[model samples]
Target chain A: MNLLEIDTKKYIPKILEAVIETWGEEYRYILVEKANKIKNINYIDERGILHYHRFLENCIQKYLSLKFLEEIGVDTSQDDKNLGLPLDSNTKEQMNQYFGNRCIFSPDFWKDAKGIFAFDKEVIEDFRKTSVEEGQIEFLNPLRGNSEITISNYEQFKQTKEYSKLLKQIHHYLDIYKKLDHEMKKYNKKIQKYSDYVDSEDKRKERILDLKRCELYQEIESELPESLRKYLDLKYQTLEQKLRFLFPELDEKSYIEFFSKKDEDNLETETCNVYALRLCYLRRVGIHNNLNIYDNSKEKYEECLKQPGTQEFIPSFELVDKITRTREKKYEEGIKEFIFTSQTFLENFGQMDNLEETKEYVYNLILNRTKVANIPLADEKNNYPAIFFPIRPSYNGILDLAYIHEFIHALLYFSLYDNRWGSGFDICDDDPALLNPYRLNKRKYERLNETITDIYAVKVKNILHKKGIYLFEPKELVNEDNSAWNNTSLIVRKMLNPFLEKFHHEVILSLVTANYSILLDKVGSENFEELNDCINKVDYLIDCGLNLENPEHKPELIIEYKKEMSRLEKIYHNMDNRIQVVTEAHK
Target chain B: MDIRRIIFIKKSPFRMEYLFLLQLNGNENMIRFTGLESRTDKESINSKVVNDTIVTNFLEHFFRIVSNWNDTYINKNTLDATTWNIVIEYKNGKQKEYQGVDSYPINFDSLERLIDKTIKEIGGD
Candidate 1:
């Protein structure tokens, strides 16, 4: 037999019988009596058909309510009135106790009944053909939009024209409600004031009539068209139900407040794109909080809404300002601390000497037997590959540091050529190939290279100081350039501190020689990729900070940078923890 | 004749300096000069004993190259190129040395390949 072709109307009585049996024999008599009353109604005329359908719907609702109460251990046999009444606090508490965290009222319970009892399109069309009123078929089927909107369907639904039209219609109805509410308040105020002053009954009655005749009173008393009114009511009811489900803690008063304010503040100004994105954000918040939307209070929902990314439906100028100020302060303090520490290292272990001697000393220390010409160009700007120093008559600590920095770059460049241990290692400007060898994109490579060079310069200074060859006092290097250099290097150093602690020189050598597989082998591929991501983020943040004066410094860049930094910190923390665990195991 | 020690050094202005020293002191004692030190001020040089098979294989190839090579090969026109020096010391206090600048004998490529292979086999790469 074809199930779809089966006449569902024939099974209604049998299904009702089964439902009544599940509620126990004590309530079976009452439910049967109600079903008989609904069946006995004359469903011939248009009005009678509507009446019959409503009665049957009410009967089913009562049966479901009683079944729920029975399952929750509520005594529904004593009174029939208890069937459809709202579950009180005591009943709700009992239900919670029985169900624990499990969802007791999900739509899945109705799945089989929905399949068996639902009238197919052909049956509904047949009914319409035979029915005296088309409206009667609507009562049986309701409207299409009454279906629930879930996270899965939300993205597709929001793209439909129906969604946009519905939002606009909702906004229009809300505007009407707002105006009517204002006028009603005025009417009530006039009635109250008149009653306070008027002593005579006839005079008081006359004044009330006069107020009723006024425009405000008439407007307050005016009714919406029945069809429009019904549509709005259905939409509003669905929205309220969804709100309650999403935020279970929301009470009636708070939902009313949220609904009204949402209409006024958001829908009034929101475009379709903004509204869709906001819904996406809300869905994310729902998933993150993991609250049973049916059980939570309004306060919990509000708190979830206030979480960092979803605090506002859209990014506001105020949020951008707050993030900027916080980042600026953090970077300022961070750079200062880094500069101080590097300078302290220099002071404790570094030697003071002239630039000429320091140049020779740093080159010999880093390059050893490989000697390249150490040229101090007359130009003030430095270049790479061929190490160029800005020749100044009186060299300060900053100049000496810059010379060391550039010289390291030159050394690393020369050392990496044809010196890699493995085949298929080639230097290229393309990002994919660069990333293949080192797990670093071009930007990451450049940033890491700069940071490594700066750190090596500081280390070289310390080595020189140990050799009793001091170049300049730490005070001379106390400038912006020094702080900037230290800031970047310090971030990278801190990120790689665990590996550096184990293989300090090897780490530097691997980076310099572009033998990154050595490091990748030590730290697994996952950690290597994470390190690459961290370097990329740091590079992006630095670039954004440098371009703060440029018009391209957008709020999105700052937000992205902030998010990346937090993620990088999390990954680094995980890596550190894993390494510690391994180390401890070895011990 | 039993070889007591072997020393190899290669330097270039545009490349990393390579230095290797091996001493047969009852074991194949291999020492590598890294040309860079740790932050803790540890010596840049590291020494370890490689297996006899690796040393024997390396020397078997090394001796063949030395037999065909001259005492010195120099390309005076190429002033700023690589310079390589190799010295073999025997147990009897006699030494054989070979030096080159920007030039090498016909078997030089094979010798370089053998050295590279031996370095990796000994975990120097």
Candidate 2:
């Protein structure tokens, strides 16, 4: 009986029909249709016979495997094993390996294999209960498709849609796990590389210090919450302390000296005098809110006095005559215009009782006519002599006083306009040293000049009042603290009272013309020098008193200032007494 | 080349002298020294740790104005004024020197004020 010549197609149908009776109609298609296709024997050759034999053998093996799995209560239609199988351990192990190696049915047939195999219902229920207790069977699974599955109900759980969906989910999770593992491996490799690079203790310490110095770490720390950031800060500070202990040369205090020594080595050729010039420039131009101008003024005076040829006196008579003539012309024109064009003056032309009505008119005329010019000195072209009116013209009285005071300054500069003698020094606009007592040269006289200006201003006011042009009241310029005129008025009046009373115009002329030699000749050189020294001492006393009044000074400094002030006051008192005696002798 | 230190000196004919020194320690800190140019007497010299940013700003401005200045400046008009000198030392052991008397650059006042502001920040008068 040759198997190939046995008419396999006719016998295969019979075998498939018998198999369907045993394993239900679900296996009908695989056994009948698939077996018929495999038995397509063209000629009865050796190769054809071999092929037919192999096909029959494979069909027999699949049938036996499925029948054995069903008898043992294993899921033949799905990949899952039926734990309800009442079999020995050796047989279970053999069946597990057999099922794992091959599928008994095609994948399309396996989809409908559930409920086709027959099993003991009670054993399946028992297995289902055990699976539930062991958390193996999912009764209310949240996955898609079948919400619940039990061993007693289905013979193949894996052939269900829910199992396929679960398989896909597992694959998705595994892919994600693989990606995470790869990233972890990469990070570990980077860490190892860095560790290998900074292997030595010294190199590690240097790397740590460099990271601490970097701004990137600070930026990252700033983003963290306050508590965590503070904790990290403490940790870093402790680490830095340890690092500093390891490196003794990085001590903060000694670092300054080290750096300074290095700088000194680099600057060995530099001298101190060059730095002094730079310092002087910085002092001159720097905007210091708390500048001690008194100390600076004293320094400037000392510097000026030390220079041999700083105090040369040379007066130009021609320049003086030119200034006087111009002043006379402007004064005449201003007075004429005031009398002729002023409405107040027109209404009360010569009425002495109505002088108050013409005060504003006279003030306007003086303010309008006062020519404030920037006259450059002969030598220093960049230096311009500017007369500053430090007072506000809020009232007619103040306006008149400021006008006359500035007029006197203008007259002084007018003489300097064409004179070569007034060329050495710069007439700085806001110079505190230009205030009083210190006379650097003929062009810079603060004490005598201010005294003369104040006296002349008052005299002009009185003269204008007598002439029925009341520009300001007599007592308007009498401020005890602020008025430079009032401060110097007493000493100047006492010292020059006799001479002023005798030759008031000549004294005024000589002072304004920068002709101090004329006054020296008149007063005698020794007495002139003494008087000048006395004036300087009075200014020194005033300045010392001002310094003593300042509350910002330290108590010890205040004590010293008081002592100096008292000494100056005594000296000034003696000088005043001597000057009075000299005036009396002159009188 | 990286600048390591800068020293500015000024001497007046009236016997007054001053020194302004700025030094960089590594890359983090700057040391400033200002006083009467008495290197031996440390008490006369005021030394303080200043911010590196301040020194950097000063150096930036210094370089800008440095181009306008010559290696030597002499004022023929006045012989009694102050004399100024500056030395810029680099990390490569090279240096640049400049000196002036009375005469100065066009924006020298700006440089003076910048140095004054920088030193003042570190408590220099």
Candidate 3:
């Protein structure tokens, strides 16, 4: 017969005594959680420190000790009776293996915390003292006689009945309930009183405030023209959230008014690209759908060409918008001069080709030999690579260049320790928020991607110019050259203002308190500054916009940025791939 | 990318809607909102068959911002270079490069302020 099958009629007294002694003082709190039978307050905060409740810990310890002592099964203990504990094979094995018939468990122990000891001092000391040569110390523990007590006998023995008084005493706590109903009735009377005063002098002031709130909501609900208001409000709340990012201090009422009014005012000029590339990418990756995305995007694409210098390039946007801007000439003239100059410069440098396809790709995204704007770049979760031009015209040049850069980004992404989602090609889904460009992750990734792109754009522009492409002219791609890229680090640092407002108070604190690592991924040593700037300032972030756009000091973005930056920094340092090598090299 | 050039300019309860933003690579890296002026109504909203230079010019203006980074030679050594301009070409054959006279070289910190100004002016008084 199993040990649990033993007749509890004999040894229960000893078992009960062991429980009482072992429990010491902590019987109330643990049982409180199991109070379905008792029905106490569920109103107490679920978030209070659980382990600190000594009463609860004691109850659990009592339960565990009773079971542990019963399993050890001492001398007929009091009347040929044997206390039995239902120890499954595994628990029995654990008991027999290291415990050697003597084990004292505190019930407060947690496991598997590494070289980092997370267990209490008693548990640690027990583990240390019980090992090998010191195993005899386990027998010397104060609990050595724990199994000798009999719980059943204690319950029946008149001499030990005094010990059960506390159990009865606990029931008296129910006395409070006698008046609880009366108190609740009193509460109802007060509520009635409050109702009676609803129209009184002081109540009128309160009613006025409530009326104001209602008026505000009604105004928000019915403020603008129907169709236009609906469209604008929906966009403001759902798609466009710039107002929220810009004015985090604005109250809910102010926000509705600000955005609704801004919408009313700008709805006349409102031109959101209903067709987003992110939606397109998500669909292609099989994570989402955009039904008529191609049709929609194609329209926007055509509209783009009607602007200028986009020429016939239709695949890449960055090449047209960003890459070619570093040159000296207007786009048309610049491309021509670049082809002519690089043809000579590369020849002079002993290379054998002209930058023809490169020029075509450059002319594809942007049209000028000047500065760029609103360039589109993409980063993904899984390796589900998107065909991003980053700007316009998606030429072989940009297709090639951004491809390598994106590939590097993809590699760094994989090295991430805290991936909130999946790992391969389709790591990212179409972000509903990407279209707004203010999402935390989206903004960070875009800035990181673009700053790196700027590096190449400046590099490519310089090499082309060094080859005598200046036959057209030279544009400053560097800040020293009087360029925005020249001082962007400082601007991105300033953009970090809003991060400060949200740190200790909300978002980050919630994550940290829950022990979820949101930004603890492996970032480069160089990027530590960007990380600190971004994080330390989270408390004040609402006061500022989401981006680090304050305090004109240039921050080392590579340092403060969080990610698998070490690997990326290595790639950034060792990379020698050009647009051609990158695009063509990747199958 | 892979854009189509057909657009519908505002006419009779309908106007060409262009998405605009301030680009960082412009001469002052000014935040400017320029979009494709509607050309023709060829499935205007969602077609990618942009086969014209006029629409292409609008996009090129964006690149022009990039090109102007070092090409600050416009009207150099003269009073003309002192002012800035915005070039606008209508599919109707009306070409105008308005002297931005009142607004130009907006400080980097205040670019959004400029956009607010432009968006405000464009919206109305």
Candidate 4:
């Protein structure tokens, strides 16, 4: 095939037209309007195409940066640098002093804008050096407030006269929150004390509950101060008022419903999450929280230091969904399936001891990978359960195949972790006998497991294909012609392939939980080879059962095979006992 | 510049594998870690003294990269399945271990390139 080359410059306007069509006429208008407003710009570079690309990048960066800043009352129209995206060393130093290393805008927001949005190279390098010299910057995403808090409102707060009143109000609310927090802790402790007194597990729970129903609890509740009760009532009322004021589109009932669902969804341990969630609510209403107020208010500066992301609101759900849908769509389905399959495999084949926590960890690990670009493909040494393939054209064809394959590897890794004896790594280092098994357990490392993975991948495809859910093109199995099949057949034909038999597969799966090195150490590889030879001879004799030429030889081979089976069973018995001892000792 | 030992083990899902352990304590020594191929039912472990400039230069750059690595991004999810565990034991009994898992320590790709180049130069592959 002959490849045709085209000039990139010729397609620039066409590409722009397509982008404008998809993004809408409004976006194009904004780009042109913003570009015209800028002063002293050189358009011609070495190539006009390069200049056009840079021009587009600059226009998008400036427009998005300015628009986002306007949301926080930065008034980019007055001071463009007020957004704190320093493109030069001079601007960066000024920003450092103003924001103290905290970016005025959230990284997520910039990430959304895209296209050369980060600080210039020199500025970034300077910041890196400073960070290394001092300590890492605690990057905070500046939170915005409701629509009422505009540029004028921020200016009023900065003047110190009007700010004092707002500071007092914030302190009053914080004091009530702290008191309520303490009371909740005290009540929980008292309930725990009462529950511990009863001997019977059932009676302990009943007595505690019954106690709560009695007048003693009422007396304790009544002992609370009237002022504190009034304050608590007022706090909830104020929060509801704030929510209604911010989201004016919603009525009182709708606000209540929103808060109920949102609060239930975010019952987090970290205090910062609450602050960020509240800030998120306020920011959506077009207000700037002006985090500098925390430092300037002089009332709760110390307290504010404890909670991070004071300046930053959590990324909006819409933004998060947009990212996942666009950039992460390639591997998202496969990843979700991979996680589901891994959990299913572990539950069915794993040791099932302390698997609940392990399952949660594995799920979170895979979920976190989906959020970031640096998805770990493989870590056999560290025994990570799953890996993600990079998004490349060469790998696209085999991604589904590899996903299931890696999921099986993860199952194998976790099954070893679930073992009572110890995790695979633990046994490798701690067990004296198992120390050499890493070198000896050559079958897994030798790509035999890969061949098995290939079989399992096909099996998974077949299962999905039956449900009309084809993940990938299923490999055609021509047993006579395939190398994978030939490799699998050799292993199966040589050693009485346990996987072929249901009960034997169960036993083999169980054995995987035990230390492979220890199992091999006890059974002795010599015995395995001998067993392999014996199984082959027995299989040959069975094949000869129908051979009229070897009628007498079949019985003789059967007798010899039975003796070899007895020897194999004895070896397995010894190995199992030793494994049980190790399991018990670890337990 | 006092290097102790370097062990490189390449494992695959297939049967063929290799283990190369190089020691540079006073007298340089190299060990070929082979599997259970010995006649007496034991793994054959042999040690030799071999001087190779490529290995020495590779070690220098490996340590340099490790020392300058920004490990702030090291997290539970940022792990690679295939990893190289480099443990460099010094003369002062201080051991510095670096693991390259999915280009972790951020400079693993460069280190891999260096090692690959050295292997090719020395005809070790």
Best by DockQ: 2
Predicted candidate 3 versus true structure: per-residue lDDT over A1-587, tens digit per residue:
11111121232233223322322224333222212111010111101111112222222333343343344442223221111112334544444432344322332233321111212233355565324213322322223334333433432432455434532432232233223324444434433332233224224333343333333333333433344344446546632242222112111112112122322343224222223332232233222333334333445534543644333212233322222221111223423333333322233222212245433433332222111111111221221211111221111112222222332222222222232321111122234543213333222233333333334334444443454432111122111221322212334333343332323233222221232233222223233334433333331232132234443433444233323234334433332233235457675
Query: Please, what are the lDDT tens digits per residue for candidate 4 over residues A1-587?
Result: 00011121232233334324432465565433322221110111111122222222233333334443344344344433321111334444434432344333321121211111122233345455444222211211122123334433444544665455544543453344334335444533433322232223224333332332232223332332343234335554653343233222110111111223333353332122233334333333333345421122223333443456432323334433332232223223333333444322344224222345544544444333221111121222222222332221112123234344444333333323422212222221233343222222211222333334445544553454345542332222111112222123342243344422323333233333433544355445554445444444443444334223454665675566567667667755554665577678889
| Model 4 docking grade | incorrect
Give stretches of model 2 more than 4 Å off.
Answer: A1-268, A271-410, A414-419, A423-507, A517-527, A534-546, A550-587, B1-50, B63-105, B112-125
Superposed by TM-score, candidate 4 places the C-alpha of residue A51 at a distance from the truth, in angstroms, of 36
Each prediction's DockQ?
Answer: 0.01, 0.03, 0.02, 0.02
Model 4: DockQ vs. true structure: 0.02
Better of 1 and 4 by TM-score: 4
Error of 4 at A268 (Å): 49
Mind giving the per-residue lDDT tens digits that candidate 2 earns over B44-105?
56677777567655654565455335698754222123567899886767788888755564
The per-candidate count of clashes, in order, stands at 13, 11, 128, 20
Model 4 chain A is weakest, by summed lDDT over 10 consecutive residues, at A38-47
Find the candidate with the highest TM-score and give its number.
2
Cα TM-score of candidate 2: 0.25
Per-prediction TM-score to the true structure, in the order listed? 0.24, 0.25, 0.18, 0.25
**DockQ, candidate no. 2:** 0.03
Question: Among all windows of ten consecutive residues in candidate 3 chain A, which has the lowest summed lDDT?
Answer: A39-48
Worst 10 residues of 4 chain B by lDDT: B34-43
lDDT of 2 by residue, A1-587 (tens): 23212332243343334334433465455434333322111111122222222222323334444455565455655422222112344544544443222332321122111121112233345455444322333322322345556655444775778656655644453344334335444534433432343244225333543443332223333433343334345544664542332122110111111112322343334322222222222232222223332222334434543545322211133422332233334333433443344342343233222244333433332232212333232333432323322121111123344444444444344223232212111242224454334422211244544555555555554444444543322332222121323325354445545545644444544544456566545555555455445555554444344333464655654565455446545644554565577788899
Candidates sorted on TM-score, descending: 2, 4, 1, 3
